[model samples]
Target: MREFMVELTTAVPEGTDPAEVDRRRAAEAVRAGELAEQGRLFRLWRPVGEVRSVGIWRADDESDLRSNVLGSLPLWPWMTAAVTPLQPHPNDPGPTG
Candidate 1:
């Protein structure tokens, strides 16, 4: 049970909204029952790409993170996105007393 940060760079094709596409991807991932299983996905951030759409997946492991992303890539949206591995952060969101 390791924590990781999964970075996603989304490139929506012409006549597409990166935000919308990303939302759709999220929904599909949820429907497929992969997002949560992959990890907690504590937080998500964006506004870091050409189209201003990036995501930070708070995943548990590499495989789970990859599977979550793959579950809804080009299928959910007619666009291309890269789910890259980012260095894990030192801080862990552990239970606080």
Candidate 2:
């Protein structure tokens, strides 16, 4: 698997129903959990006071990440994601014991 750093920003369109937004948000959370359990989602963080998140994700490739993983999100239509492929550094300490 390949790793990627993904930053996502969400913007609900104007005039959208509040109930619909709530429903999608809930579904998004569920989907996120599934991805996490599958080991595709590694870590996530939200910047203070921002409607955005940064996360580390794993996938077979960029195409798989975009299509199967990211495109599956319920809020994907309203989300803008920036994906950066990650490479291991020789000086990296690796995982903690």
In terms of lDDT, which candidate is strongest? 2
lDDT of 2 at 90: 94
TM-score of each: 0.41, 0.94
Per-residue C-alpha lDDT of model 2 across residues 1-97, encoded as one tens digit per residue? 9999999999999999999999999999999999999999999999999889999999999999999999999999999999999999999998877
Q: Clash totals for all models, in order?
A: 0, 0
Give the alpha-carbon lDDT of every model: 0.54, 0.97
Q: Point out where model 2 deviates above 4 Å.
A: none
- Summarize candidate 1's per-residue lDDT along 21-87 as a digit string, tens digits: 7777677566535555655554555663444344556545667656654435444344444656666
Highest TM-score against the true fold, candidate: 2
